[model samples]
Target: MSNSVNLDDIIISKRALHLSENSSLDEMADALQVQQRGVWPLYDDNAKGLEQVQVKTFHYAQCNVKVQFNPARIKSSAAKVDNKSIKERKCFLCTDALPPKQKGIPFNDEYLVLVNPYPIFPRHLTIPRLEHAPQFIEPYFRDMLELSRALKSYTVFYNGPKCGASAPDHMHFQAGNKGFLPVETEYSKLKATTDRKLFSNEHLEIFAVSNYLRKFIAIESDEMTLLQTAFEWLYELLEQRGQEPEPMLNILSGYENGKWRVLVFPRDKHRPDQYFAEGDENILLSPASVDFGGVCITPQEKDFKMIKAADLIDIFAQVSVTDSYFDELCAAYAKRVVE
Candidate 1:
């Protein structure tokens, strides 16, 4: 992948919005509307796909999860992320490879924000780096925070290369409308009820949440530096557990009222055994940040209709770290932060 592609070749002048440190939510909302209207035919078709989408909510003891039967997401759900497959295919996220009808808003001179055609949210944006790079969060976690703040109407999220990312060869972050995910609305109550405080300071507070089907660490802060430091620390700790290239994780970040809330879901595997199972036992689910956040996407209508709450519990358990490991991680994190 070459970084020599000119920005003008990809950006539609009329649709492009200037994003900066002081960009406002209203400005982004307007830009998104303009872009959608500018690419009317494509978005209009995607709107029809959205209309076909169906949802079913399963109630759990501590929380509820919505399973969406979105047939348009089959490409992403069944993506071949293996090295050979990735090498043979073109990176769809690259500037030159983008669809002819697609237009983007230039952000911070480094990223381009484009509307997602196969969307789970009513308003979804995929932000990819202008330069082609591998998916890795260590170097760009700060960028995620800034994007969440600038795109205040959206929640910014990352899916690890080996986990949920379809274009693992390209570096990207996705943003969807705020309050769209169940976890966003449930976080405050979960924090007060089930989350165990791991660390706290004047600028940052960290908590480990285990009751949410999947185990995860949550960091809340009004300061970017503190948030970055805490995230990097957690990344290092997870890395020490021996995953190659990078640790397996998915993240969801949101900014509101001058504060940033980041949820990190560490994974032990990409997909559960059910994904590879044959015949009637098979499921096509590939869990990602959104899935961990409370809405799981099922590309096959049969899988969606047949999946039960017990299946969800088993799937989450198979992909997430064990309860004992989570306990140890919490203890270690608490001790390390105080030191």
Candidate 2:
């Protein structure tokens, strides 16, 4: 299917711009929020859901995980992303398929940043490519870096096709207000004390954070090219070990203090067995970058209230790569960097 909608057709031109030619993406996004709330009733209602959302925190030795009871996220948490189901449904991320009232800010004539109607953060933005494409990160990882820098106040994240993307066939990245996730605050502490250093130099540093409930690789650098090169190497390493078309992983990135910090959450499965379990056993929780970052989303209130620390441990264990595999991958990457 073709994304036939023109850039001019969906760009929030009038009020969002304030007649300014140099409005930053962050400013434009704020403007889009105001315009969307007034013009889009569905978004307005869901945006209000953020207020009623309940949260409970579970503390671990090294970090804490927050479970958000967000009823508005049922559409995404329970999204049917199977190949057959995906083929039958229209692509919602496509510009032509968006609601009439929905509008966005065009980025470098490549992506359209639109307000997410079903939000998990106080301010949520969904940035989708202009063309219809599969959800893959390698080719667009640099774009993510650029977006994070451009929207400095937001954390840009990617949910792999099988990792957490509801629309697995579409290419998109999501941005939420910074500090919404626990990792944004906890990562520095982990890095200083417990995280295992894989590689480091003047331009780039990579560390493996295995103590966190979910295992992830952290890449940090002040230079964009160096960061991108390190990520590409890591991507190749992941591809060599995985059977999937693309290595199963979710990425969370942010730009602050003239540097980019990227976290890669490698996955072994999309959802835990609890997701498919019968009635009382079923916990409708589908983890994405936010979840890995420590704010686990539970669409159903029952799951929210009943989910315990042990259950989260079990879920993370089931979805994340095994400890042995993770260690081996880290070792291999560390060795490769030196050679």
- Which residue pairs in model 2 clash with each other? none
State each candidate's clash count. Answer: 0, 0
State every prediction's TM-score relative to the real structure.
0.94, 0.97
| Cα lDDT computed for each candidate against the true fold | 0.87, 0.90
User: What are the candidates' C-alpha RMSDs?
Assistant: 2.3, 1.3
Error of 2 at 74 (Å): 0.9
Query: Local error of candidate 2 at 75, Å?
Result: 1.0
In the range 209-318, model 1's lDDT, one tens digit per residue, is 89789998999999999889888888878998898669999999999999999999989999999999999999999999999999999999999989999999999999
- Per-residue alpha-carbon lDDT of candidate 2 for residues 24-68, written as tens digits (9 for 90 to 100): 888888888888999899999999988788999999887899999
| Global local distance difference test of model 2 | 0.90
Model 1 residue 196 distance off true place after TM-score fit, in angstroms: 1.2
Top-scoring candidate (lDDT) = 2
